[model samples]
Target: MQESQSLLATARSKLEKSLLAKGLRRSGERFAILEEVYSRNDHFDAEELFQAMHQRSYPVSRATVYNTLDVLVDCGLVRRHHFGEEDNSKSRYEKSLGRQQHAHLVCTVCHRVKEFCDPRLHLIQTNVGNALQFEVESHSLVFYGQCTDDACETKPTDSSANTEDSRKTQE
Candidate 1:
């Protein structure tokens, strides 16, 4: 965890310098969003992050969070997950620095995400790209399972899925 913190701090510092080099104005709000993500121990979606920040008295808008997350994703600093085939709407995100090519185990009941890093999976990615002769840009692999929670086990089967609603954000 200490190493992760140090890596994140270094990455943030370099990112700030890069922005300055590109003649772009540094954004305190964007830095705040990135810092929150890098500091979190659990995977969180944008809406979850918004609620958490609001509760903590952080002046962070939902759009700002989303936009900042988009920047991080583009810059290869975060990983985004859209789990399951039935619901593409349930999206989540996490920091990807120092954690490369990991799969997710998302509980269908509680939605708790567990990270899995398999080298064999990494090999497959490389092999598939070679065999298909297509350059792989990116991929998302998530496995859905039941949680250990007893309450989760008792939930009705095939009921209306838990959905993330429109994030309240100031345009």
Candidate 2:
């Protein structure tokens, strides 16, 4: 909890500086949106964020939510992701401040997202950058497949067959 609070504080300061640099008004609505975003642990869309704000008794317009998200993304306070080809139009966002770089696993059936970090991935990035003589600042990797959770909306009738089929398709 203390760590989260400190992260939020740092994010607030960054947002303040960004807004000032852009000559934007330091409004309460923007701060409220930031606080709401930092309080969550899931990737969310702009509509979900707007609804969340209303649920928290802080009514703000959809436009405000969308515009604020754009500002946050620009200021590096938020990370936007387009997870799968099927949902190219829907963009999901997560707070980026004080968070380590990670990869995502997207459930094609349920559209659920899971995040993981692997040191090998970083090492591969470094090696590839060195080999290509290119500076790799960052990378985004997403693995898309059906999740095996019981609550998933669409579950394979035969897990073994499904796995085999997935492998064949990949190959």
Candidate 3:
């Protein structure tokens, strides 16, 4: 918790500097959004962030949340990801403040994301970029499959049970 609070404070200071550099007036809504984003260590969507703020009576609009997210992403303070396919489509965002570049394992059925790192993968990325004569600024890699969590293992005894499990997973 102390580490996160430290990171959050650092993130806020950086955000203020970025806003100033971009010639944008600092706003409470932006700070509130930044606070929420910096507080969490997991990926979340705009609606999720907005809802969290609203639940805490932050008095921010959905549009503000979306727009602020765009600004954050533009300023390199956030990383946006489109992890799943059409039916399960959603754009998730995570703070870029104190994160190292890593890959993701996405559960297709449960939508659970796990981060992993491998030195070999980093070497491969560099080699591949060199072979293709392209400079690689960054990369997002996602491996998709069903999760091995216990909740995901239970076979549905009936259609209703399956629906309940699906709903829970989505939540």
Candidate 4:
């Protein structure tokens, strides 16, 4: 518990600095939202955060959560990810503060996201960018595959369905 609290405090301090640097005012709503985010150690969507706040009777608006999310992302306090679908179909946010750069392993069957770190991947990115004559600012590497879970193994794999899902995401 003490470690968690310490981490939260550190995150709050970083957020405070970022907000002040951007000339943004600090408020209870924004702090509460940030606290809620730190409470979770996994990826989550905006609706999930909104529901959690309302369930706790925090008295935050949907717009406030969304707008604060934008600010947090802009200030580099949070990281937004689109796991599979194009139009953020599985869009999620994860706290990036104090977290090292890593790649993701996404389970297509269960939509589970796993984080992994590898030096070779970083080197590959650098080599690819250098070869292509482009400076790589950052990268999001996601490998999609079925998990070893029974459900995932039993799930049907259909290419047409994936195509349809992609089309729907585009729309």
Give the per-residue lDDT of model 3 (tens digit) for 76-163.
8899999875655678999997788799998866677789998888898999999999999899899998776777644234687789
- C-alpha lDDT score of every prediction, in listed order: 0.75, 0.93, 0.87, 0.86
Worst window of 10 by summed lDDT in candidate 4 = 148-157
Instruction: Assess every candidate by TM-score.
Output: 0.73, 0.89, 0.81, 0.76
Q: Which ten residues in a row have the lowest lDDT in candidate 2?
A: 152-161
- Model 3 clash pairs are none
List the candidate 1 regions with Cα displacement exceeding 4 Å. Answer: 17-24, 85-87, 134-138, 148-171
Worst 10 residues of 3 by lDDT: 149-158
Off by over 4 Å in 2: 156-171
Candidate 2 vs candidate 4: the lDDT winner is: 2
CA lDDT for candidate 4: 0.86
Over the stretch 1-171, how does candidate 4's per-residue lDDT look in tens digits? 897788789878887898899888899999999999988889888999999999999989889999898887887778999886545665699988777889888887777778899999889989999999999988888899977766565465678679889999999
How accurate locally is residue 28 in candidate 2, as Cα lDDT from 0 to 100? 97
Query: Tens digits of per-residue lDDT for model 2 on 1-171?
Result: 999999999999999999999999999999999999999999999999999999999999999999999999999999999986575898999999988989999998788899999999999999999999999988999999989898876665688678889999999
- Who is ahead in lDDT, 1 or 3? 3
Candidate 1 residue-wise lDDT at 83: 70
lDDT of 4 at 80: 94
Cα lDDT, model 1, residue 31: 79
User: Which stretch of 10 consecutive residues in model 1 shows the poorest summed lDDT?
Assistant: 162-171
Q: Who is ahead in TM-score, 1 or 4?
A: 4
Cα lDDT, model 4, residue 29: 94
